[model samples]
Every structure is written in structure tokens, then in C-alpha cells.
Target chain A: MNRIILGVDPGSRATGYGLIAATGESLLHLESGFIALPAQLSHSQRLARIYQRLESLISRYNPEALAVEAVFLAHNVQSALKLGQVRGVVLLAAGQADIPVFEYSPLTLKKAIVGYGQATKTQVLLMVENLLGLTLNNHNTADALALSLCHHFHSRWPQRSVSPAAI
Target chain B: MNRIILGVDPGSRATGYGLIAATGESLLHLESGFIALPAQLSHSQRLARIYQRLESLISRYNPEALAVEAVFLAHNVQSALKLGQVRGVVLLAAGQADIPVFEYSPLTLKKAIVGYGQATKTQVLLMVENLLGLTLNNHNTADALALSLCHHFHSRWPQRSVSPAAI
Candidate 1:
């Protein structure tokens, strides 16, 4: 059976997204890119753009699920608030499309991609490239692809209890 | 000319909304209430509920503007993040409807409704009831109506430059 997954790395300024198809035991990249919100747009406008873009992506690809990074609490109050706003829209888009959403911590993403939870950004990027058999330049896109791959790997191990959260 | 305004007091657990109609020197309360989200619902489900409810409100009232509290930095990082997620959906609903949004600080809300920045919650609620010619029990609804009144008062003074932010 073949399943398509959409992964998103959402931000206030830029939201990166990647799509992949899983067929039996092979993973193939379908698309990867980032939506760049100009500095001139207000915060509300930026959110609107993120929602519209993701809605269009879902419409185009009709993915089976959405994968994203879980909430990271290391940021200060202001930054965390801003980041949460971005994540809110990302989740809203998924909810509107009735697609299941899965969240993976940064450490989990690193381990899935680079075989270690504390792997450096460069190492994760290199390993993702090796796994996907492609050269990637955008860190945001790379992270999004890494998120998709994490879900793919997790879905294969039903005994590990890697089901989507009850959202 | 009569103009409608929607005020929102967004939170993760409950989001309060109120509607007011401005006719010359009079402010009339149209509706006010809070949406209570059960803890059993996940965070994403909560956001989706907020978005859907607000969208229905916008569709029902067709308000000319949305008034909400500005970002309050007093809370800890986690709380701020959760609150921001709620605010994000509020803004998104307004944005999708092409309604302008205005933000007022708590100090400003108190001053507008109670004639002082340091007024107590009871004082603000009483003043809002008096101003709208109604009795209110829900603090969330009271705060939301106060926000609408704040915009009403600010809009009357063109010299104060109380225009909507470029959102």
C-alpha cells in the first residue's frame, strides 16, 4: 500500500513543507519548499498566508496525514507566543482538511534522521540527503523533510505505539 | 451610520465574544457569551473550535471590525504560548472575513470602561453593564464588551489617532 504524507515546519516568517510517498519499504520525495512571508505583511496577514498556502497544498496533494515538530519550550515568552501562533494555523489547516496530525520532538527528529538524539544540524541534513538521495539547500525544507521521514519510520513500527495523538 | 464591532477575549480553555452596534452617540449590545472547551479535547481541537465558532459569529453579525486585547507579557512562557495559539485563530477568523482588527491593552480597556487604568474587575464589569444598559455575570463576556466599548470610545476621538493597526 502507498501512503502520502505532508510535513510542515511552521514559522512566523517562513513555513516549510515537504511531501513524501511511502510504498511498501521505499520512501520517495514528492515536493519540498517554503512559503516566505514578506516583512511588510502584518502578523494576521502572515497567518492568513500560511493557512491559504497549506490549504492549497493539501488540496493539491491530498496527503493522508500531517507531520510537524512538537511544541519546543526553550524560547522566551514572546518568541514562544509568536511560534505558537504559527503552529496554530498549521494545525487549523490540517483540522479543516480532516487530516490526522502527528507531532515529533526535535530530539526524536534528530534520532530518526541521524541515528542520535543530539546530532548537529549539519549531520542531520547530511543524513537526510543520504536517505532521500537528493541535495537540499534550505534548512527549513530539510527539517520538514526530516519530519516526514520520522513519521514514515515511526509508522512502520506498530509495536512502538507511534500512533497519532487524539487530535 | 450604524457600525458593528466584534470583541474577543481569547483563551485556551474559553474564548469570549461580544457584539455591539454603534449608532451616533449610542452603543447597543447585540450579544455576548463564552465558548467553553472541555479538557478532553486536544489543543488542536480547541483551536479548531475557536476558529469555527468565530467564523460563524462573523458570518452571523458581519461586524465591521474586531477588537481584542493586545499581547500581555506578564504570563510565563508556556501560558503565553498557549494564549497566543488562541489569539492566532481569532485573528485568522477576522482576516478571512476581511475585517479590520484593533487591539487595546488592559490598561486602556480599564480606562475606557471604568475611567481609570487600575480599576478592579468588578468595577469594569459594573461600568460595562451601566454603559450598555444591561446586567452581565460572565467576566469573559464583560471583558469582551468592554473591548468593544474601548474601540467605540477610541473611534470617537479622531485626534487621538486610534486607528486600526495595519493588519
Candidate 2:
């Protein structure tokens, strides 16, 4: 029985999440979707909702571990700050569930999925579909799932070379 | 009639707010207090509740402008992140109400109210009441209100301070 993993691509406006079950060299997609909070809601409420929704999902899926995108700060100072807020809420949710969570840099996640550090959203999406045999738009959530799957594949390699042991 | 302004001090556990009507060099406290969201609620539900609560307040107060604290990053990275999320929700609230929201740095707010740029949190709480003629403990929220009042004062200052002719 291979371990199951959950992947989350987090954002303030909408978060993309994907779940997969790892079985030896192959992987299975269990579920994936987006969590959205419009620009209209207060920051606190949006965070709270994310926490609640995630909690429910965790209870439903009961994955062995969670893989989330590390906070990214590209150009927008205000956006980075807002992302930190969203990240806080998510950390709390993971903590409450006592689930071990792993974080991957955008570059690492992109490279792991598409063999390149600078994969675009479209490329990542297409690669995820090709790898997973899904005929749906994964968008951010699907991308996150791909990251999770990538991590699993690399970690389980007999060479132990996917991510560093430290990760 | 001097412009009326709403000031917000946001906290994940509790959000403080105040409204002041101003004319000339003086300010009148129209209403002030904190809006709290229990930590137990999911982040999404909290956002929903804040929207409802703020909608009522905005309709009732019809403030001319809004002043909110720019998100601050302190020592604890996690806490700062949570605060940022809460601030986002609050900013969204003001925007939905169609108020032109202004933000002030904590130090700027402190200097305006307490006469010192490096005022302690305790000092800020005390001086906020001194400036606004109130005696209460919602320290952080009050600080937010104080920030609003400070902006109100600064905005009314001779438009000549920063390239006066531009004003």
C-alpha cells in the first residue's frame, strides 16, 4: 500500500489543492480543486474560511502528509505581505491536524514536474495532465498536486535523490 | 463640516476600529470599539461574518474616508503572517464599502498620537486615549483608531509640507 499525499498551491484569492496516492513507481489522483475567497471578503475571514475548508478536507481524505508551496515573493511587496497572512492560517490548519507538512520552492516544484526550473503555468498544466492521464484543467490546484507527486517519486527512489534528506 | 474618517486596527483574534468626525484642529469621537472573531471559526466563515458586520457599520456610519494600519512584520514570522492575512480581509472590507482607504506606518501613527516615533506599545495605548480622551484597553484596535485619527490630522495639515504648490 503506497502512501497518500496532499499538495496545496496556496494564494490569497484562491488556493489550488490536489491529492494523490502513491503506489510504488506509479501514482493515482484522488482529488483536486480550488479554494477561492473573493477580493471582497475581509482578510481575516478569507483566512478563516481556508482553514475551515482545509480542515474538512483533511478529515475527509486523511492523507499521510501534506506538501504546500513555500511562500513566494515576486515583485509585489503588498502581495507578499498578504500571502504571509494566508500562509499563517494554513500553517495553523496543518498544525491542528498534526499532519507533517513539506514546503517546496516554486523553482523546485516546477523543475520536478517539467525538468525545467522556468516552466510556465500552461506547460506545468500540460505536463501534469500527461503524467497523470487527466483530461481536466488542473490550474493552480493541479500544479500543486503535481509537486506533491514529484516529491513522492523522488523521495522513494532507491538512490534517495529526489529531494535532499534534509527536506 | 470637517471630514469624517474610519480607522481600523486589525488582529486575527480581535479587530479594533474607531470613527472620528473632525473639524479645524479638534476631533470628536463618534464611535469606537473592536470587532472580534473567535479563533475557533474557520477562516472563511470569519471572512463572511466580517463582511456582514462591516457592511452594517459602513451603511450606518457612511464615513468620508478610512485609515488603516499598514501590515507590520515583527519578530515572530508566523504571527506577522497571520496579521497580514487579517489586514487583507480588513482592507477588502473597506474597499467593498467603497471607501478610499489610507494606510499609515505604525511608527508614523505613534509619532502623531504620542509625540514620539519610538513609543512603546504601552505608551501608544495610553497616548491614544489621551489624544482621543478615552480610557480603554482594546490596545491594538485603539492603536488602529489612533492611526486613523493621525492620518486625518496629517491629511489636513498645510498641503504645502510636501511640495505645497502640488496640493
TM-score of chain B of each: 0.95, 0.85
Residue-wise C-alpha lDDT for candidate 2, range B1-167, written one tens digit per residue: 77788887777677777888888778788887787777666554554455556657778889877787665454455456556656655555665566666767777788888889898888888877777798878786677678767777778866622111000
Model 2 reproduces a share of the real contacts of: 0.20
Which pairs of residues collide in candidate 1? none
Best by DockQ: 1
DockQ for candidate 2, please give it.
Answer: 0.13
lDDT of 2 at A86: 63
Measured over the true interface residues after superposition, the C-alpha RMSD of each candidate is 2.6, 9.4
lDDT of 2 by residue, A4-65 (tens): 88787777668888888888678788888889887665454566567678778889988777
**lDDT score, candidate 1, position B96:** 85
What lDDT tens digits, residue by residue, belong to model 1 across residues A1-167? 88899999987778899999999889899999999999887677788888899999999999998999877573688787788788888888888888888989898899889989999888877887888899998888889889999998888887754656543
DockQ of each: 0.59, 0.13
Query: What DockQ does candidate 1 score?
Result: 0.59
- TM-score of model 1 vs. true structure: 0.95
